[model samples]
Target chain A: MQIIFQIIFSLFAIAALGLVWRRRADGLLSKHSALWWSIIWLAVLALAWYPNSTQVLADILGIGRGVDLVTYCALAFLFFTIFRLTIKIESLQRDITKVVRRDALEKNNI
Target chain B: MIMILVPAHNEAKTIENVVKQLLFVGDKVVVIDDGSTDDTALLAGNAGATVLRHTLNRGQGAALETGHTYARQSNADFVVHFDADGQFDFRDIPRALASMKEKNVDIILGSRFLGKEQKIPWLKRAVILPFARNIDRLFGSVSLSDAHNGFRVMNQRALNFIQLTQDRMAHATEIPQLIRRYNLRYAELPISVSYHEFGQGPIGGFRIVRDLLVGKFM
Candidate 1:
C-alpha cells in the first residue's frame, strides 16, 4: 500500500509540474501563478510521501485521523478553486456585457 | 417624449405585440433582444421598434442598462422600462407620466399591490411578497410597497444617476436602493399585472432570493 501510494504521488507531482510548465509556456498561466501551483504540488507530494506527518498535524489540530485532516485540506482547496473560478466567471460576464452593449449600440447607431 | 425600452429574452411569441402596444402609447420604442435564440429581434424590428441585439444573454438588468445608455445618448425626456411578457397595461402609462410631471418626481415606479385589478398568485403573495419586502426594507433606502415590479418610468436625470450593476433579477432591488443613494425623487403608481401566462414557478421565486443574497455578499 505504501509503495503504491508513493508511486501515485510521484506520478501526480510530475504531472502537475509538467502542467505548470506547459501553462506557463502557453502564456495561459502567469509566472507567479505557475510558481504558486508548483509549490502546492510539491507540498502535496511531500504530504503523500510521509502520511505519518499528516497524523502529527492531525494530533495538533485535534482531528481524529490523518485521513480526516487530508480530506479537510482537499475540501478547502476545492472550495478555494471553486470560489476563484466563480469570481473569474463573474468578471468575464461583466466584460462581456460591456462588449455586447457597445456592439448593440453601434449596430443600431443609438 | 416617452421612449419605451423593452428587454426581451426568448420572448419571440409576444415581442411584436408588446412592441406594438408600447409604440402606440409612447413616442418611440426600443427592444433589447438579449441573445434570443428565436425570432424576437426580427419580430420587434418588424413591429416598428428599433431593435438592439446583445451578442450574448447577459440578463434583463443588463439589457435595460444597454437600452438606457442608448436612451441617454438619444436625449430622451423620459424612458419607460417595460417587460416583454405583455403583462403591463398600456393605459397606465398616461397616469404614470402624468403623476411624474404633477409630483415633480424623476421616476414613477409601477406597483401591482396598489391596485385591486392585479391577480397575484396566493403562493407568491404569501411567500415571495413578504420576503422581498423585508429584503428591500433591510437594504433599500426608498421604501415602497412593491420591490420587484419591472414596470418603471425614469427621466434622463434618474437614468444617469441610477447605475445598475446586477445583470439579473437582483436589479429590481438594486434600482430602489440606487434611487435612495442618488436622492432621486420617486413615486409609486397603481398598475395591474396579469399572471395568466406568467411562467415563473416556485423555483424561480427561490432563485431570486438566492441571487439577491449572493449579490449582496459577492
Candidate 2:
C-alpha cells in the first residue's frame, strides 16, 4: 500500500512539472516563476521517491516526523506566497490609479 | 491660483453646496467626482466647479490624488482639501490659509480638538479618534491633535513635495508622515466639524490601521 501511495505521489509531481513546462512554453509564466515552480515540483518528486529522506533533516530540526516537517514547510510557503501576492495586488492597484488619474486630468485640460 | 480640491463620491446631496461654499473662499474649486452613480459630476459642474470624473469608484484617497495632480498641472499656488459631506465650514478656508502664512508653515491641518469643541459623535470623540491618533503617531511618526481631519491647506512647496500613494482613507495618516519626512512646516488650526451622521466608526479605523501596516511592512 505504501509503495502504491509513493507511485501516486510521484506521478502527481511529474504531472505538475509537465504542466509547468507547458505553461512556460506558452509564455503564460515568467521565466523566473517557471524555474521556481520547476524546482518546487522537483523537490516534491525527490521526497516522493525517497519518503524517508526528510527524516534526517526533520530530526536535525527537532521535528518528530518527516511528514510533519513537510506540512509545516508547506504552510509557511503558502503564507509567504500570499504575502507576495498581496503586495503585488497593491502595486497593481496604484498603477491603475495613476492611469485613471492621468486620463481624468487629460480630459479636463484647462 | 489657490484651488480648493473636493473629492466626492456619491455625495450629490451636498456636492453643489460644498462647491459653491468653497468657491466663495477660493479662486477655483475643482471637484473630483469619484465615480459616483449619482449626478455628482453634473451638479458640481453646474455649480461652477471644474469637475473631473473617474470612470470607476476608486476610493477617496485616489480621488484626492487626482485632484492634486490637476492642481499641480494648473500651477496652483495653494490647494485646500475639503470634505464633500458639508461637515466642514467653508469659512475656515481663509482662516487656514492665513494660519499657514502667519505660522510660516507650508501645511495647515484643521483640528477638531483645538479651540472650541465640535459636535462630534460621542463614540468617535471618545474612542476611535484617540486610538487613531496613537496609531498615527506610531506609524506616521507625527504627533497630531487631529490625525484624520479632511480639511487641510497646503502651499506650493508642500504641493510639490507631498505625493499621496495610499488609495484609501489611509491617506490622512500618509499626509502627516509625508510632512514629517519631507520636512515641510506644518501646524494644526482649530476648526469645527458638525457630524450629521456617525463618520468613520471603529471598523473604518481598523481598516485604516490595516492599510497603514500593510503599506509599511508589506
Candidate 3:
C-alpha cells in the first residue's frame, strides 16, 4: 500500500513538472514562475520517494510526526498564497474599473 | 450649473420618475446605469437625462465616480448625489444646496435622524445606523448624524477633490473620510428618506463594513 502511494505521488509530481515545462516553452509562464513550480514538484517527488526524510526536520521543529509538519506547512503556504492573490485581484479590479470608467465617459462624450 | 447625478442599478421601475423629478431640481440630470439588464439607460435617456452606461456591473460607488467625472468635465457648479430608487425626496435638493451656501460648507449631507420625522425602519434606526456611525467615526475621523446618506450636495470644491475608489457601498463611509482628511466644510441637513422593500438591510450593512475593512487594508 505504501509503495503504491509513493508511485502515485511521484507520477503526479512528474506530470505536473512536465506541464510546467510545456507552459514555459509556450511562453505562457515567466521563467521565475516555471522555476518556482519546478522546485515545488521536485520537492514533492523527493518526499514521495523518502517519506521518513521529513521526520528529522519535524523533530527539530518539535512536531511529533512528519505528516503533521507537512500538513501545517501546506496550510500556512496556502493561506499566504491566498493573501497574495487577494491583493493582486483587488488591484486588478481597480485597474478594470479605471478602464471601464474611461470607456463609459468616452462613449457618452461626457 | 447644477448636475443631479443618480447612480442606478436595475432600478428601471423607479428610474424614469427619479430622473424626471430630479430634472426639476438641477440644470441637467445625469443617470449612470451601472450595467443594469433592464431598460434603466433607455428610460433615463427618454426622461431627459444624460445617460452613462457601465458595460459591467460595477457597484454604485463606481457609477457615482463616473458621474462625478462627467459632472467635472461638463463644468458643473454643484453636484447632487441622489439615489435612483426614489427613496430620497427631490424637494430636499434645493434645501441641501442652500444649506451648503448658507453654512459656508463644501458639502451638505442629508440626515434622516434630524428635524422632520421619517419612516426609517426601526432596525435601521435603532441598531444598524448607530453601529455604522461608530464605524464611520473610527475611520472617517468625523462624527456625522447620518453616516451613509445617499442624498448629498457638493460644491465645485468637493466635486473636484472627493474621488471615490471603494467602487461599492463603502464609498458612503469613504466620502466622510475624505471630508475629514481634506478639511472640507460639511454640514448635515434634516432630510427625509422613505424606506422601501428594495433598499439595503442588516446584511448589507455587514457587507459595507467588510468592504470598508478590506478597502482600508488592500
lDDT tens digits, residue span B1-218, model 2: 89999999999999999998888899999999888999999999999999999988789899998999888888999999999999999999999988898999999999999889778878888888889899988885578988799999999999998888889999999999999899999999999888877878888988888788779864
Best-matching candidate per lDDT:
2
The sequence of per-residue lDDT tens digits that candidate 1 reaches over residues B1-218 is: 78899999999889888888888789999999999999999999999999999989999989999988988889999999898988888878888998999999999999978878567888777777777778777876588988688999998899899777778777888899899898999999999887656455567656666666656646
Candidate 3, residue B187: the lDDT equals 92
Better of 2 and 3 by lDDT: 2
- How closely does chain A match the true chain A in each prediction, as TM-score? 0.88, 0.88, 0.93
> What TM-score, over all chains together, does every model reach?
0.92, 0.96, 0.93
- Model 3 over residues B115-136: C-alpha lDDT tens digits? 8887877888888889989989
Order the candidates by lDDT, highest first: 2, 3, 1
Evaluate residue B171 in candidate 2 and report its C-alpha lDDT on the 0 to 100 scale: 94
Quote the chain B TM-score of every prediction: 0.93, 0.97, 0.97
Q: Which of 2 and 3 is ahead in TM-score?
A: 2
Model 2 chain B: lowest-lDDT 10 consecutive positions: B209-218
Cα error of candidate 3 at position B137, Å: 3.1
C-alpha positional error of residue A59 in candidate 3 after TM-score superposition, expressed in Å: 2.7
Number of colliding residue pairs in model 3: 0
User: Which stretch of 10 consecutive residues in model 3 chain B shows the poorest summed lDDT?
Assistant: B192-201
Candidate 2 local lDDT, residue B63: 95
